[model samples]
Target: MRTTKLPTIELSLVTLRSIQKKDFKDFFEFGKDKETTEFLTWGPFKTLKDAKTMLKYIYFKRQQRNEPIGYAIVSKETSKMIGTIEYHTFNHKGNSCEIGYVLHKDYWKKGIMTEALQKVTQIGFEVLDLDKLVIKHLRENIGSKKVILKNGYKLVAIYEKQHFHTKTGQYHDVFVYEHWKK
Candidate 1:
């Protein structure tokens, strides 16, 4: 096994760095928003304690693992956490990983996520030396589809009933996208 570290990534509008305890408030802000957590697997935090517990788990994983699994997406101007992006899954043997992210609803469709995704994918390929990167979004998440396509990820597959939606209490199809290092 190879150990890797998450490098701080700076972009024109945002900075991607390790999540910190100080970011709990911002984390809660987005995590508690139903619209923000709509397409995500977990969230819509019921209370500050819920947010704190989740943040603690993230930090705990970082402490125990050899590399970071997630990052806080901070706005450069306000220095506030507006989102999170992460390589949630890794396959060392295949040199590949699956990436995921979420942004505050207020920041949606503003190109912030597009910029962040571009930078993070670059990190996955250039910094982490990954041969391939994958991302999946609910079929209804057109915004995510656009971001994925804009970043040059190709639609590889659509799995039926691939995800269980907590809010809807039903299964939904998922669109899988992929980018291969050239």
Candidate 2:
């Protein structure tokens, strides 16, 4: 099930809004970076076709129907799409979901994800009324670790070879975490 009102989180640095068709080029800008997608399970998007397919199937279709599945993190200063974040996996029966996100390489180490995550966490608890929120990160990704932990997500497990990274062509251990609504 989807929320009746698609979330629109406002923050000092960025505004999390529904991804738009006008953001196509900006989306491609970050999605196509091999370095940016290094630890991610998906994307170093090769072609505009790949970008369009992903944007349409994953974001646009739902957005057009008025229930956006995710958000585009638009920078306030430049007003450009810098990243995407959302509860990618939903479990209404359990009242929990998995959060996922990606940011432009240039924006890394700027505390952007942490700020965005704080807002998303608020939405999961306050807006969605979810009982808990789950998140995962590649063990090697210290950046993800920091963001997850900074938002009060607790480490639950380290599953061995849990993810097959397409870019690396190898399996890597994954760390699972959860944030109980409090």
Candidate 3:
């Protein structure tokens, strides 16, 4: 049976657990913060319904397909959802997956993301049996790059002018990252 318990990832100031429907409110606040989502694929949520729908879809996907694992970062002391993370893009035949994460601005610079990434990467290689893992960050998202690097992912390539960014309405570069099982 699929586990109902959310995996725990501890950091200096917070913990990470599977994202839940109840976290929609906290997620809405974080996702709607322009500065917090400036480098994300989709964010700066326009409405509460938008955030709720997105979180619901993610939770449903986790329950149904067991892929695209999504988690909420929570403050350890307060037990409040503060952010999110995902391990997605499974390639069955290729024996690989990709990862991504986001943290609330209030929790930035506290090494929370780096700790979360380490745990997620361990799950990818150990539980998921992935042979390789990949990650990408918007070229200018320095915080994301730092977390990935701290978790042992190596810079691979730059997909220059790759995505037509919706927020900026222009092409942007993405830094490719990769990690291999030893």
Q: Each model's C-alpha lDDT?
A: 0.86, 0.84, 0.80
lDDT of 1 by residue, 1-182 (tens): 24467788888788989788878889999999999999998889988888888878865475566556578999998999999988867676788889999999888988989988998888888877889999999999999999999999999999999899989999999999999998
Model 2 lDDT, full chain set: 0.84
TM-score to true structure, per model = 0.92, 0.91, 0.91
| Rank order (by TM-score, best first) | 1, 2, 3
Candidate 3 structure quality by residue, lDDT tens digits, 17-48? 77778888988988999999988878899999
Residue 51 in model 2: lDDT: 78
TM-score of 2: 0.91
The segments of candidate 3 whose C-alpha lies over 4 angstroms from its true place after superposition are 1-6
| Clash counts for all predictions | 0, 0, 0
Minimum summed lDDT over a 10-residue window in model 2 is located at 60-69
> Residue 20, candidate 1: how far off, in angstroms?
1.4
Q: Deviation in angstroms for 127 in model 2?
A: 0.7
Residue-level lDDT for 157 in candidate 1:
97
If ranked by lDDT, best first, what sequence of candidates would result? 1, 2, 3
Q: Which residue pairs show collisions in model 1? A: none
